[model samples]
Target: MNLGPLEIGLIILAVLLLFGYKKLPDASRSLGRSMRIFKGEMKGMKDDDVRGKEEATTVRGQLAPPAAASPTAGAPDYEAEALAAEARAAEARAAEARARADAARSGVTPADGTR
Candidate 1:
């Protein structure tokens, strides 16, 4: 059914009357938001359908993600690396503390390196 200008005007008039001028802006904003949400959902469904068609050849259970492409992707010792880095940082801090103590005993600031 074709909605002419008259039909559109009647619909607008009805809506305006149903929701008074004070509430018209809020009602229109909600209507616009709902329409936008509906549109996004429809687009998502279409994208999902396209994705399904693209992966139709692969079985759901047997599908494995593609192997890592980077050279270091297989180095799985992350915790060891983190621990080693933490140890190095601790050693540096210890050295700095010792320097500060020696400077304090000699009545010099380690930062100035002067007597």
Candidate 2:
């Protein structure tokens, strides 16, 4: 249903009469305050989630063993190289999982391997 200016004015008049002019300002102010508080809380939660993800990413980066962390001075360290590759694959899987989780949180259904 669409309301023109006349209908809107009538609704406003009814609300003013029901709520009283003096109480309306206080009610509106409280509503604005509540909205601001809600927005602040949502922002804090988003920031915290982002910060947690950053920390997790750092931890994932650090998961490589000491040997796998860098090139060795001795003959080719095959084992360490393998570990490094495994760690990288694991991190990639984790990143995909994180992406899926983020999509889920945002109410977007993640697409499977199929079209």
Candidate 3:
């Protein structure tokens, strides 16, 4: 399995004949450009992956430690907090409605309650 220099030359000649010298230059230029773009894209993807991992690590580090804020016997219930928020929102709406009705009865024109 030894291909001598002459055989290699013949192979090159055959390839040159199959694709003319003019076309070969254009093809080689396009191939080089394609390879360059592929290499650049791969580098960009690797950099993005590294950046993403670093960002994840930074976010993880920024978090409060588990021991610092563990649930205790006196912790407030989330459900109760949510219900309280809802109640406050309802009260605000009711207050607004009452104020609008009072303004309408008094025939007072506020900035936004013309309707």
Error of 2 at 22 (Å): 0.6
**Location of the lowest summed lDDT over 10 successive residues in candidate 3:** 56-65
Global lDDT scores for all candidate models: 0.59, 0.62, 0.61
Among these predictions, the greatest TM-score belongs to 2
Error of 3 at 93 (Å): 49
Candidate 2: tens digits of C-alpha lDDT, residues 1-115: 9999999999999999999999998788657655654565567558656755554444436543344377657755555555575566557656765665476446565577310
| Model 3 / residue 23 / CA error / Å | 0.4
lDDT of 3 by residue, 3-114 (tens): 9999999999998999988799777755765565456556755865675555433443563224445666886444454456556655765675566557645657556733
Write candidate 1's Cα lDDT for 1-115 as tens digits: 9999999999989988888889987666656655654565567558655655444433344443334534366754434544565566557656755665576556575685522
Q: How should the candidates be ordered by lDDT, best one leading? A: 2, 3, 1
TM-score of each: 0.40, 0.50, 0.48
Q: Flag regions of model 1 displaced more than 4 Å.
A: 1-13, 59-115
The regions of model 3 sitting more than 4 angstroms off are 1-3, 60-115
lDDT of 1: 0.59
Give Cα distance to truth, residue 98, candidate 1, Å. 59
